[model samples]
Target chain A: MSRKLLETEGPKWVAQGIITAEQQQRLTALYPEEGRVVGLLPLLGSLLVGLSALSLIAANWQGLPELVRLLLLLGSMGGAYAAGEYFLRRGANDSLGIGLVGLGLILFGAGIVLTSQMYQLIGYDVTGLLAWAAAGAALTFLYQSRFLFALTVCIGGIVQGYSTGQLSGFSYFTAALTVGGLGWYWWRRPDAVLGGVLASGILWQAGLLISFLHAKITWFFIPAMLVYAAGDWQPDRPAGRALQAPPLVAAFLFTFGLALYGETDTYAGLLRPPLLAYLSALLAVLALSAAGKRARGRLGSLTDWLLLLPGFYLPSGLALAVATLVVLYAYSGAVLWRAQQEHNPDRITLGITLFILTTMAAYFKLTWAFMDKSLFFLCGGALLLGLSWYLRRAAARALPPKSE
Target chain B: MATPLPLARRHRLVLLAVAVQALFIIGVAAAGYATTAWGRTITLRTAPVDPRDLLYGDYVRLHYTISQLPRRLWRETNREARPNEPVYVVLQPAHGAYEALGVYASKPAIEPRQAVLRGWITNSWRHGLRIRYGLERYYVPEGEGRKLEKRPVLLVKVSIAPWGQARITAVNALAK
Candidate 1:
């Protein structure tokens, strides 16, 4: 309500000269909701198409014939252009719709050109990947879809860090930049999809960074703490109030806690980052949840379970592995719970990443151990089954009970 | 609410621009590649000099093959060699492609029977090619001068042509 008022009120204020031209531009560009039908159409359409394209690209990894892949990538852009033309001719060129479709085509085309050119040069080297990704991001800025823009840039940063053979430093930097920069940008305007994109990138990037950069755990907490502090003041809009802040706060605090427990550091100040991060995130999410519990009379969102990740970590090797399994289970549980609550794709993705990471970690652990490999396998298998059962129970419990 | 921008058109334009640029760059690269691989090239043998880079590592900056003035061009000019003087050289028979001819001094005021080659010589005791201008030295890899074996190895002559064009021709390798 207040958020809606604030958003509608903002443009008027700017028109009245209350806001500077640049501020007005930035704010308006941050969240464009015009082109009602067309705007809505492409965003929905692109969601499916984009996902398919991404899956296909990922699936062909390592096995893709370079020449054929290049041609297909380029051809995809051409198809997108034709689609855009059709939309334009069909009178879907409303400002918002045009912007959305334009953005989609731009992304599709840029993705093709860059993928081919970059693959040609470095065979998917870090520099080329980052460059192409940055180019796509630049397109995002032009199209004013920070959600996609932020995602591309974050992925680019991760690829760059991966290229450097270290996931911690570069990934952290890119994640922080993408998350914090876009987070702050969208926070002012508070678009749901854009905010979700920012949060997702931060979660994955931070998770990956922590997994790699265990040497300094405290540094991970800085942004988490900042995000928590920022999420304190709830925005008036539905997009900002209910969706964006809560999950971000939960994920950050959870990751920070995990960083504190799992990462080994001798420095006395090492734990402060995670401590501060977790506390702030906890405060923000709890504050939001309390508001809903008090006023809305609804159960707390399962996103709060992100906090369990940090709390479950243990120092003992066997205990730590068990706790990791627990955290992964909790992560999946929270995603499923959120999916049931909101029926959003974001939740689905969170669930998927949790499953993938869990499977990868278990595989790595099982394959690397020397003696007692059988025990490792047995225990890991037991944990997987146990977690699967727990998740199934959690999902079943989340459902409304059937009448006896 | 305003109408959305037609994304497809904008995307096509963007792709077109990128593709054009890529094609242009590749074309230039191909041309250079062809010239290096198949085209006739005269080698200028030279010795290596030292150069340093702050960020990247140091390298031995190599000198050229035709490092000195041709004796025939020098004697025919009838002008005594002077120190710190610029010279100009011209190719008599134009090669199939652009080629670097050795350096000489100024052209004669009166038309001579033969081309007045103005090759300059330093007043140094060794009577060798002087390092008058080093920024323009063209270098090729060592032992790649099989084509230049028939032609006289011209000295590293620096010339100021009639149109103020400066060229160094007849490059020879410095004796190690």
Candidate 2:
């Protein structure tokens, strides 16, 4: 709650015999005049500096002495961290310190890349990225830096993508880190637990998806479904009240996967259609069970289940895929109606968002003549804007007046 | 994020970590320099690869003549190299490029400067022995790699030390 709200309400509560003025004063004193919200400027400044450093190293036209490049890498990476630490010792400059540390990590990875570039090393594809992620993860665990948390997740995802597969053993390392890192985050900061879980989801899914992409397209659905199911295993606390990682990641996979199938029709695969379909159906049930667990007490009622629903009717025809979206639309409309009756603003927003996404996904299945394509997209976009405005009005009307 | 460390102690640890990380970054470069400075240098003709990765940015995905070995080059009792096993390509300077005289299941020692490039077999079957040289990547300056890759014209200078430690020295665009 805002300090202004508490102060304004305190005297009223005291007058109504809710509490004494002394109690009100005590309550107001609990929260500070200005809460410690992290400032964005320092982080942005450090990011720009990091980017310039990368660009300078990458654009090595001078063919400077190899030793000089090495020194540059070491100097920047070490210097940034040292400076960040110095600044960090001052209590007020915490954000600036964080930003500098972030730059140090970036330069650290860039140093590795630049070294590889200098000597022209090979087969070190995911090795450097994985190493960078490892360092970032370690720092994140120690310092509890959110920037490092995000950086580690990104680097780890890239590492997982570049590593050929589980057989390469790098993917296994990434998976292990995800589990380890998630545990560390949960223990250190209860508030950051959801973010940790989501990062883990990225680590878990990217390797699986890429490996499947390389091996067999049909097998990709299993991991996609599996991650979706895993998304529901949120902590049994208010902290897990954020966007669950597994399901959102699964949704991303579906978006890309469906877009691929919608664009390119490929019949070639390792497993036959019947078996793949059966496997998909089995995963759908598993995911539904997990989703049910999450729905025990969660917001965005219909949103979580949308990605899971379509997997059941897999190896879908373009027509079938388009048709199934009708079911999605009807489901969302039901949630919308129920939300309106119950005055649940969150559900109403989720319903509208899901409704639009289904419509957009349904668009790819469509085929328009070359001349009419532009017109079709223009009309579709205009329709979406109109729908968004309508939903806004509906939600605004359904909400109750704010109480002081 | 446990009980906050004493400020001075935390600063010391941060300094130590920063130093360690710096050493790591520089250590890789030192290793890179060591490989090139001490290793024997060899020139090999570039072969056509997928070319997508090489044609962009500071890193070039190089495919050398030794990377694609003929079945006859596999002088093993078995027709193909074992799957996921390291295969050494015994190199002899041919008329132009270094030719792979044989692919060994294990490291085969020879006279000094006689190159024996080591690589892992992807999947070796009859009539083929597919292997990847750790020498496949050749980094260049931004936008300069594509020009070096002009077809009918790409010679790469490679330096190799013991235990298959290798580095790309130069990728010269030799005119036919």
Candidate 3:
């Protein structure tokens, strides 16, 4: 489909009478060569010029008068925005324009910090930097650029971090703004890459909130699962799955850790919250997620929740460790079965990797003390190779024959 | 997907956003100026700093005398002082500098000679509590940080705005 492909393969098609030489020429003409290399020259030139200006300002920053410093901050920020707008209006170099806009957003944050430092001012609350996140969200909406959306997510994280780490208070307002402003944007747009970015950003904030409250880390899942439930409700399948990936990965890692360390009663004790309250909150989120899956006819993915089973509730012993392994095996097995049914090669690879990982964990936990070291290594390596070969063969057989 | 806004609308919105940002930055600068112009100034004494601690960067790390207080000075009787809890400290000018009179969970009424400053409890032990006033770091001009850091002790002048904002107006080495 690319010009390069046609340029290389067109002759063969013409020689075989699949198309005439003239037709091949027309087909090749349909895809024009991009001026990507030429475009880079100007981008590089501008970058060098910008760097020179930055270093110069940084060198003279201390000697500059207060008003001049303020003017410099404002002037550079305004220049970036104006140039962004001009490029956007020209309707060429869209990435360059958006990059400049992103720069402007960064400068706005720098402006806030520098201005405060200029007067040796200290704000007890997040009100000063909150404006930076607000501006990011507004620019994201106005531009409707994924780049801006991602930038805003990062700004939200930074603001929350500063609030909790420096001010010793969590800014609920900033958290809500990110979830509402960017969440609404993602809801309407439903892009795969943006969905992943949004979900991960929200998860990061959720983790911070958990740490801020000093709650038992188990409380993290309540908000994390809420994010997963939101993804289940998304109408776009791929985008929804992308949003769900982070929470699922987090859950999987937690469960895997539980498997590896569940033999210790102390660690398991730390994981247990007020059992009834935690279960009720988790159940409510589960019901919401189930309803969403059912509504979208994606009930098959309900098995993804297998990793969230509260196996730690079992008294820590051999029984607890064995139970966790069972859960891991069941979850990875489900992935393999689902991948095979859907004939998705990528998922098949993922499923195989997960299956092999669980096996290694199981082997290490069950056999390390009892088996001889050399024999253990030999058996483990052989088992993995054999499992991989068998899975790949099965996957090959499951796929429909290739047309080409 | 929702359609993007028209070019004219987009341009206007972007321009408006940029203008608002510029204004917000200026407003921050104004707040800084106003804090010094309209607020009450109080002088705080910094504890001696180990020379090695000053080697980090272009900012001098100041440990104020009021950063730590005796446990009995915590005025809350109903419950214990918790770490990271924001508390108001009443300071009365004693000797040559303001010293902590009491630490309260809520803002306590102060007499004409006393002032209340807010700080977060960083740590608490059997005998005392450590508090941070968000005025610990004094950013200095390039190469000047080292000069300031070499001083054994300093007197930091802070302007506390009526609205609860505070800032370091000046830091001077305490005369022996």
TM agreement with the true structure for every prediction: 0.35, 0.66, 0.96
Per candidate, native contacts kept equal: 0.00, 0.54, 0.82
- Model 3 scores a TM of 0.96
lDDT of 2 by residue, B94-126 (tens): 877787888887778776646887677776766
Could you tell me the fnat of model 1? 0.00
Better of 1 and 2 by lDDT: 2
DockQ of each candidate relative to the true complex: 0.02, 0.36, 0.74
For TM-score, candidate 1 versus 3, the one ahead is: 3
B107-135 in candidate 1: lDDT tens per residue? 54433312222323343233444433332
Which residue runs of candidate 2 sit more than 4 Å off their true CA positions?
A1-64, A164-170, A182-209, A212-231, A236-246, A252-303, A310-319, A330-343, A356-398, B1-6, B33-90, B101-157, B169-176
lDDT of each: 0.47, 0.66, 0.91
Error of 3 at A213 (Å): 1.3
Q: Report the C-alpha lDDT of model 3 over A272-310, residue by residue, as the tens digit.
A: 899899999999999999999999999999999998898
- What interface RMSD does each of the candidate structures achieve? 14.9, 3.4, 1.3
Model 2 complex DockQ against the native: 0.36
* Span of 10 residues, lowest total lDDT, candidate 1 chain A: A116-125
What is the per-residue lDDT of model 2 for residues A1-404, given as tens digits with 9 covering 90 to 100? 77788889888999999999998888888887763446566767878997897687556633667778778778878888878877887767887788889988988888887677676765433556667878878777667766677677676666676565422434667766765674456435645455545545553555465554455444544554444444445444334433344444455455435543633335424323465565567567565646656576544443545544443244546654554566556656776877888788887897788667666666645544343778888977887899899988988988897787
Candidates 1 and 2: which is better by TM-score? 2
